[model samples]
Target: MALEGAAAPGVAARRGLGMFVVMIGVLISAVDGTIVVLALPAIQDDLAMSLSSVTWVVVSYLLVVTVLATQVGRLGDMYGRVRMYQAGFLVFVIGSLLCALAWNAAAIIAFRIVEGVGAALIAANSGAIISELYPPAERGRAYGFNAFGWSVGSVLGVLLGGVIVTYVSWRWIFWINLPIGALALVLAVRVLRDRGERVRRRLDPVGMITLGLGLFGVLWAMTGLAAQPWGGTQLAFLLGGAAMLVAFVLIERRQAEPTLDLSLFRIPAVTPSLLASLLQGLASFAVLFLVIMYLQGPRGLSPIDASLLMLPGYVVGAAVGPFAGRLADRWGPVLPATAGLAVSAVALVVFALMTTTSSLWLPAIGNVVIMIGGSLFYPANSSAVMKASPPGRLGIASGVLRTFASIGMVFSFTTAILVAADSVPRSTAFAIFVGSTTLDGPLAVAFTDGLSTAFFTMMGVMALAAVLSAFRGRAGSPQRRPDGRAGGQVPA
Candidate 1:
């Protein structure tokens, strides 16, 4: 059997509990990631940080999580999935406490790294844990529920973040994670008791370090774009990062058991879905902060009211998720997934067109359209990737999916900051985005002008995403074997 600890007498009950814990993990990670976006201004004002430096509050978490995702998944396969997953909850709680106690830029960044480590552990293993608990026949539905966790969690983050940043201290954003994480930890320890499957493999330390540094250098260069022109320092880091990435590629080819198995891309179905997800992430994630900035900045709405406008989208997404998963199961991932991307592109266009007198409904209505697209896309793409994976490497496949998604998110975070930096003073843009301050006069008009450029650029990305999604091949088409030595039909 692919899963090792699922043979107990009350297997069904354990599976149900197993599903619950995994879902909770999804909720916690999702909420934690976005909760801080609305509070960035508060963090910057309180800490006396540069506007450019403050974006790290969001980017750092994504960067660390991106770096560790695959490595942690590999560790899960070597040790125990449930054990590592449970540990994530404990560590996340500790990190959250530290963040709440933080006094300045360095302390907050350091503590957030701790939180990101914990987040990586939870995110890397969530899919594998659920995959281990559920048989192949039921995976699509399970993934749909995972999507449910994501939608609900995002909704909670925006709503709760608004309230805390407005009334309570911004520190409460991290502090709030305490009770929620603790409860999840308690349940995870009690309910998720499976030892899970294992594979005998050595950790690829060289590959991990090289890849980590390589991505870090590139991301750091991108982050610099927010502040000033690319100088010698940026160019050096960029080149060095590229060199390290090249070395990582060479090292992986020579290894018996690589950190990232290059062969996973050999699966036709897997590659396109991975790219589609990357494009989707690139095209979407940071738009949340952009819209929030618009409402909280020039529109002069409070954070709470701004976020309230987004409530409808999340509700609709929560409603759409399960049914879309069912559709992917019945038809195939290609149609629904691609269509979702196309639909979301229209929403991006709508967002690009928001004017000074636009109704509060513009973003809210645009969000609804985008979430409907997300509800269709996320589960379908996830189902496509997991279903095509060999049982043994499911963890890595899931890790790769997460890795690509994180890479896109890192870019999204940087891209938003970079684009916004063009029209507003970097500090002011960052401050206005997080609601540390408001904008008026020519500054508001110029900021909107910058947003127009950014959104138009994003529309181009969405178009690319739609094309990639379209090329994911027919749902029932045959895909290459994971090992690349044979062929198999994609399960309908």
Candidate 2:
């Protein structure tokens, strides 16, 4: 039987347990997203994978997660967030088990796709679920904690992946998920409860197809642009993807329950916050990827060392994120978000300058600054989006936000690869790190130049984001519902 009503107070004593369950799943998903990067060398040598095949290991998972996240979020709204969350855990665990048993690169990539699907389900609804559990006033705090999981997991993935691959085996990476996932599952079953009303609605099959195809096409183009000629088959996919995306927008406009709510973009507050989140994502994601390459390739650092070098930035950011959230609650989100982006822009400039020299402290300091800026903006941006969205559409809004972040990451990755490819031979491209302090050859030097260009480009984008955030602040403050609940009332 379907569980109804909020859990009784006695039952609600386990709400913390529910939160724990959600956090564990979040950590697992976040860790898996980057853990494989650290283990790639081991995996490649053990499985004798070609470069292209190894790339698939990461690409496949990302592709699956990005495509399915929004749909899964809508599903959570239609059914129950808890049910979908648990299902995600189960699917993820199964995929992990499959990944552990894989004998070849093909098998591993296939299992990763499955794992990604599970991740999509959890990632899409985790924020909304957490928001439902907490009151509007405390939502920022809750989100801060949630973001902490993501930050910690990202750092741990680098460190743990290094230790695991070095001492144990790459297989242990997947095997580790079993215990953590099981615990989360048990707690979720015992503790989590949903109070949101479920509605029956027809699935927008046309809209879904169009969005999926369009995004797939764009991502494929971006991915191909890394190694293939710009005018070749890859460009074809990019053009096709763009066209499909246009069609998707048209179809959504006509749909009764569009998979995507185009109208939300019209809201004064929603567009800016969302755009800010995307810009932040674009800068942060690209920088991390390029920095990692720079460390490993030209700097001649091992994976473990590279991971360690990046740790301070994440630690500082994670530690300060909650405080930023608290600050956002008191002041408007605009000030913090704008200030954060400005700091990030400055940090990127410093980073670009540091690449001209080989001082470890320069990059480390720049990383810390960038992270602080990111931490400050993330919670504030999220709060703004949540406050701006209609209560009835919270789940959808959360999903859209996550989707934008994912889309930004996709573009960042593609952009990083394209920049690298333009300067280096396809064979040695991945190994080229773009920084001022290190140059191995002409190709390496060119790669560094490309990296500089990308950072400058990111700085420009973040500056624009800061300006937009100020505009968002000027928009009338979010009007609360008559009952005084910020997010509980349905949209009129």
Candidate 3:
């Protein structure tokens, strides 16, 4: 018998199960992301790490993911999304195990790089996987559910990280992933089959190396400048990175099979949606860290307590995601997605209004508002990009999207610290960030003002994102096949 919209009975089941596996991957990734934040203090103390070294634990993962996301996504196109996705799980699991058993700062940082590679593989392919599973009209809802996984995982991460770091060892944070990763691997094997034709393109080694080195150089400079004043070393790296990136662009123009696939920008929906995602990411990701810094630094709350205040937002975001996605399906991506960015911009205004003595409810309310905006934007935006992607280019499209977002993320991390440090000593700001110290009185007020400046800057960024989202035009319609799958060529 057929299921909804003429899908075969087992086809629906397989799609459903495949999505479940994908959600698990997202969940594991989200949990790892937030869980590590709260546990950093413990990890630093145990490993006897300096603030700079401890910070690398987080930077290492993000840098690796940012550098490799596109490369791994290309691998998905060349091989199979399912196969590559499963490989991600195995790699992530092993990385987690190594991290849990890490002997020192370097060891954990190296293992985190391994974890980042796994994360890159998973993230780069997930959108392509969803696009292959569901028709264009249904992709928004699927992405909404994916957002739900992120929300739930973030909640679990905060709760579990707090409890484990306080009562148990910090190692338990990584250990928790073992069983979950194993289960996801088994389920993915049973539920996922490769769909769509794999594109066999030669890997562009020069492109990968140039892009990777360029990103590393720029990112290294940014992060270093946060801890130290502008110096020759930082300038050299920054200029060198720019030069390499220019080289990468020229190289891509020459390559028959480019790593980045510059032609994907030909799709009308692809360019704006990606820039919106990048700007929104730039404006959004740092809010969590900034808020936590405020709470822990000036408000004198513990790591767990500070994070708990944001829990309500995550819960609300999870509930709102699927609904916003459905609206995207009906009304197209521009309306809801743009509206979401506007809402987030307003939330940033509220955050900027806060002071050291402001009511705790202020940040709490702002968190809820911002999260609602995120819930609305993320799924719709993702659906737009995937829907516009040509079949053979889906993996690259997803990778490019991920690469842009990760670049924003890594930079956002550095920006938050540097911007906040403008009003206080860099060491104090760094200490508060890692939950190693707190401030009071005059220092607290100055720090709060600094955060407000950052918030206002982000608000401007979010406004730009909203404008981009508003002008993305419309994602083209694809004809549906008899089996309820999208047919016809996607418009460029």
Candidate 2 local accuracy as lDDT?
0.74
Say which prediction, candidate 1 or candidate 2, comes out ahead on TM-score: 1
Weakest lDDT window of 10 consecutive positions for candidate 2? 430-439
Across residues 341-443, which tens digit of lDDT does each residue of candidate 1 receive?
8888888988998866678889999999999998888877887787777777777877788888998888887888778878988777767776778887789
Best by TM-score: 3
lDDT of each: 0.81, 0.74, 0.87
Candidate 1 minimal-lDDT segment of 10 residues: 478-487
Residue 262 lDDT (model 1): 75
The superposed Cα distance between candidate 3 and the true structure at residue 402, in angstroms, equals 0.7
Give the residue spans of candidate 3 off by over 4 A: 1-6, 477-492
Candidate 3's displacement at residue 162, Å, is 1.5
lDDT, candidate 3, equals 0.87
Q: For model 3, how does the per-residue alpha-carbon lDDT over 1-492 read when each residue is reduced to its tens digit? A: 012352688778878888899999999999999899899999999999877678778888988887787788889988998889999999999999999999998999999999999999999998889988887778888899998898889889988988888889999999999999999999988888885687886778898889878887887787677777899999999999999999999999999978777787887888899999989989998898899889999999987788889889888988998898887766667888999999999999999998988999899899999999998999889988888887787888898899888878877887887898778987888889989999999999999999999999999999999999999856554444677554554444
